[model samples]
Target: MFYRIITLKTTKEIWQTKRSESNRILGIVNNVRLFGTNFSNSRIFQKLLVIITERFETTISSLENINDLSTIILAELLNAL
Candidate 1:
């Protein structure tokens, strides 16, 4: 989980709006939060309202699948087990 609040010059009106935006953003994304913005009434809001999708996990190998072990090492591991 992560949260960020960029600070910039702002008035009270925009502060309330961004607070609501934070909840609305969390409703859709699993782990995220947003606070006041540096700019109001700008396209930054639209850009921020993006999915920002990307790969979360990558393929990794575990000891159960040690397919590239040498014969001697394999024998040693089996004997140690």
Candidate 2:
């Protein structure tokens, strides 16, 4: 069996692409949650809120509202890991 080796450049490119896609999707979801009256109270939204608080070690009220949560998550992934 042959194995493929990935280069640093390829890894970086893949990371950048995934990050961009994640940010795009997060923005779309955030817009829907911000505008859709009933979505804010949705179970998924509440779960997301809990996750954010846990990840940042801060309460939801203490966290500053950001339009792009993916940036925060990506930064944490890069730095915290």
Estimate the TM-score of every prediction.
Answer: 0.24, 0.37
Residue 35 displacement (Å), model 2: 0.7
lDDT of 1 by residue, 1-81 (tens): 112223434556456555554454445332322454343322332332234222101111222244333232322322222
Q: TM-score: which candidate is best?
A: 2
Clashes of each: 0, 0
Rate residue 33 of model 2 by lDDT. Answer: 68
Worst 10 residues of 2 by lDDT: 1-10
Mind giving the per-residue lDDT tens digits that candidate 2 earns over 37-61? 4543244344555554243443344
